[model samples]
Each structure stands twice: as structure tokens, then as C-alpha cells.
Target: MKKTVKLTVNGTTYERDVEPRTLLVHFLRDELGLTGTHIGCDTSQCGACTVSVNGQSLKSCTAFAVQLQGAEVMTIEGLAKEGELHPIQQGFWEMHGLQCGYCTPGMIMQSVQLLDRNPNPTEEEIRRGIEGNLCRCTGYQNIVKSIQWAAQHKNQGQTEIPEASAPKVDPQPIAPVP
Candidate 1:
């Protein structure tokens, strides 16, 4: 049997009939065409399918579309407003937080939630906050820096690129643009 769900995504309301078994990730990606939410593992381990449901970042792959009835959802597509990038998005871009970019959307979503809770998260807190999300290409240093950048610049109303720390990983380093 199909169930009808009302979702408010990115400030837009959408009503659709969907299978009860349909995952929220698929409902957003396949149904609503919000491809920014990626399905890296589909088992919720990779954290690539993260989305904001009622202002909390969770794995969409594990959530049923029907469970989100009347819920306000925010995907990566919803982060920007009026063609301008959200501070988090700008942080990622300026901090070189991503490479290959498969895990970026989820990372940003999770980071935003973290910042919402703790605007001035320490480096360790930022690390602990994003421990759920994984990025294969970029070492976590830049990702942490990105979140830090977002946290620092979130309410400042100014944009400034910060100097990146050396990657803690050995051998291969993902260099950022100077």
C-alpha cells in the first residue's frame, strides 16, 4: 500500500504518494529530484545520505518516507538562498573541505547541525561531531577546518579564508588552493 506524505523541503512544500517501504533518501532523490543527498553506503554507516529532519541531521537511508509526514526537511539544495551560498557551503569551498565531493553534502548538513548546537565547537568537538560522516578523498583536516570556518564566520557577516593546517595523515596530502 502507498502512503501519502507531506514534506517541507528547502522551504517548499511537496505532497506525494509513496510506498511505505521507500527510504527517505530515495524519496528525496528519486521522487523530489534532490540529488545532492547522496547514497554512499545505503546502510547508514557511511553517513553520506544525511539530511536534516526537523533540524536534526540523520541518515535518510534508514528513515521511511512515511515516517516524515509533515516534517520539515533540509537537504544540500536547501542550504543556499537566492543564489548565494550558505556559510557552511562557502566554508567548504574556501576551506577545501571536499575532494571527489561524494560525501560533501552530508558533511555540510551534519556540520550545520553541529554549529547550530555549538557555534564555537573546539577542534576535538568538531572531530567528534563529524565522526559519523566519512570522506575518502580529502583527509579530515580540511573538513574540520571547513566546519571551523563556518563556525567562526557564521554570524560575522564577513568572509575570510583561513590558513589550513597540515594534514595529519601521511604519504598523500590533498593540498588546498592558495
Candidate 2:
């Protein structure tokens, strides 16, 4: 049996009928077409599926979609506005916080809550804040720097990085390593 779930995501309200067992991560990615919420570990260990649920950071894979009735969810896509990047997104871009980019969305989502709680978190505090999110690419040095950058620039509101000044990324499909 399918249950109807209504929730507001990224300032948009959506109502859909989904299976009772559908995970929120799957609901977001599969149904809502919000693929920014990645699914790395189904056991909720990796924190790759983290999203903001009613102002709290939560691992989307751990919660069923039906469990979030009338919830306000914020995915990575929600961070930006009016073609401007959120401070954390800008930080990640400027600080070289991501390498593979697989974990970037979740890391950014978690960092959003972290900065919300403590806008000017210390280096050690930033380390502790994102401890749950595991990044196999960068050793977290740049990630920490990225969060610090956001903390410093957060009060400025949406940051508009000029196109010429921003780094140019040529995304090519990765060929599997034998």
C-alpha cells in the first residue's frame, strides 16, 4: 500500500504517494529528482545522504519518506538562491574542498547545520562538527578550510562569484580503473 506524503523541500511543497518503506533518500533522488542527496551507506554510517529536516541535519537513508509528514526538508540544491551560491557552497568551491565530488553535497549539507549552530566555529570545532561525514578523497584539511571560510563569510548572505573569477570545471566521465 502507498501512503500519501506531503512535505516542503527547498521552499517547494510536494505531495506524492509513495511506498511506506521508501527511504527519504530514495524519495528525494528517485521520486523528487533531487539527486544531490547521495546514498553512500545504507546503514547511516557514511552520512552521504544527509539533508536538513525541519532545521535538523538528518541522514535521509535512515528515515522513511512517510515518517516526514509535513516536514520542511532542505537538500543541497536548496542552499543556493537567485543564481548565487550559499557561503558553504562558495567555500567548497574556493577552498578546493572536493576532489571526486561524490561526498561534496552531503558534506555541504552537514556543514550548513554546523554553521547554523555555531557561526564562528573554531578549527577543532569544525573538525568535530563534520566528523560524521566521511570523505575518502581529501583528508579533510580543505574541507575544514571550506567550513572556516563559510563561517567567516556567512553573514554576507548569498555570495556571487564572478564567472571569470570562478574556477572552470570540465566534467568528464570517469573511466573505471582496472
- Candidates in order, TM-scores: namely 0.88, 0.88
Off by over 4 Å in 1: 159-178
Clashing pairs in 1: none
At residue 171, what lDDT does model 2 achieve?
63
Per-residue accuracy of model 2 over 1-178 as CA lDDT, tens digit each: 9999999999999999999999999999999999989999788888999999999999999999999999999999998888888889998988789999988999999999999999889888898999889999988878887888788777665466555635434365533322
Q: lDDT scores for all predictions?
A: 0.87, 0.89
Pull out the clashing pairs in model 2: none
Worst 10 residues of 1 by lDDT: 161-170
Residue 38 accuracy (lDDT) in model 1: 96
101-175: candidate 1 lDDT, tens digit per residue? 999999999998999999899988998999899899877878888888788788686544344632333355645
Which regions of candidate 2 deviate over 4 angstroms?
156-178
